[model samples]
Target: MRRRTLHLAAVAAAALLLAGCGTQRDGTASPAPPPSPRGCPAEVRLTAADDGRALCLTTGGRLRLTLHGSEDRPWTPVTATGGALRPVNAGVAVRKGDAVAAFEAVAPGTARLTSTRPLCARRPGQNSCPGVQRWTVTVRVTAR
Candidate 1:
């Protein structure tokens, strides 16, 4: 009687283990499918032309900014206002005198991304430039 009970217990345990293995009717195990991507526009690319323009984005997406500048009057790094967007830590490689920065959508809200450079280059030890140049854009983020 004890031997029969042990045999039944072993069979039950084996069945439970195989139940979640996702076997097909033909007795072949099927691989689990990959998770589907969620959200809209996985990445948003921006340029100087986007300045002052309103943009939309989905959560968990990236924002890439590329602005033009010269060596003497290069743009400062991009900055985002409010809490909707956060700067990406990985540095973007600059190409052809373009100033680049990357950010990630963190929450559902509005944010202003801005970058600025000097209108004219100043000499070394100069405290201030003659004028300031600016670039900015508004972004609206939502969960999709």
Candidate 2:
């Protein structure tokens, strides 16, 4: 009787453990882990490849965006919609080089970031082309 009880208890504990280990077999993502002791997780990094997509973040999360430009047509500085995402720095994309911007999720809301450059590269004293290239991403922030 004692051995049977122990075996049953062990089986019950194993079942509970397996149930608690959630899996994404349904093609849905699990929830984000809770923040660390510093009240935020590591900064979420983005690149030019992320353009035109939407992202989700939690309050107190950090975001970093980096975009590279061609030799002649460098990208302009980046901008944020503000309110939900607060700029951690000047928020301006670097000029004449790879652009970078950083922000922190402050509130539960939506925001957008954008930058642009002339589509056609021009030589010195040349008139710039009317066409332009743009990069943008939308961010949805949720409360932690």
Candidate 3:
């Protein structure tokens, strides 16, 4: 009788071990996928100074970008010129997707809201120098 009891216990232990072996097998659920790539990949290339960030290399000194006002907002771009992005003018409202007023950080880093011009531009020369409202994102710059 005792021998039979020992045999039953061993069999149960083996079954439990086998069950755990397949826990991570095909029967288990798969992990989630990584984030999708962005339309305009946020990156910047350089020559001598690499700060542990992404980059791009080019020959000519041409540029690549298309400034767009904030999504639904109505702010305009004044003078975006920092890191890599830029704006055409310097006297428009500060919209969401609109270009920034003036950027000058020519490296790889974040571009959050530094300053902003919230309310309507009612003051005197607010039309000429539209105040900034918020910084958008980290702009990578490839020195020319």
What is candidate 2's lDDT per residue for 1-144, written digit by digit as tens? 999999999999999986554224563333433445644443578888766656678888889988888767778878888699988873664656577889989998878888987788867898878898878777778777
Which of the two, 2 or 3, has more TM-score?
A: 2
The candidate maximizing TM-score is 2
Stretches off by above 4 angstroms in model 1 are 1-40, 95-98, 123-129
- Show where candidate 3 strays beyond 4 Å: 1-73, 82-132, 142-144
Task: Estimate candidate 1's alpha-carbon lDDT, on a 0 to 1 scale.
Answer: 0.75
- In the predicted model 2, the residue pairs found to clash are 77-93, 78-93
Q: Model 3, 52-122: lDDT tens per residue?
A: 22323222222222234335334443333343443223444544544434333344332321223344444
**Model 2 TM-score relative to the real fold:** 0.63
Clashes of 3: 27
- Winner by lDDT between candidate 3 and candidate 2: 2
lDDT of 1 by residue, 1-144 (tens): 999999999999999987545335664324332324653466789888766556677889899888988777888878889999988864756754457888899998888888888887755777765787778777778786
lDDT of each: 0.75, 0.75, 0.36
Steric clash count of candidate 2: 2
RMSD of each predicted structure: 19.2, 11.3, 18.1
Sliding window of 10 residues with minimal summed lDDT for model 2: 22-31
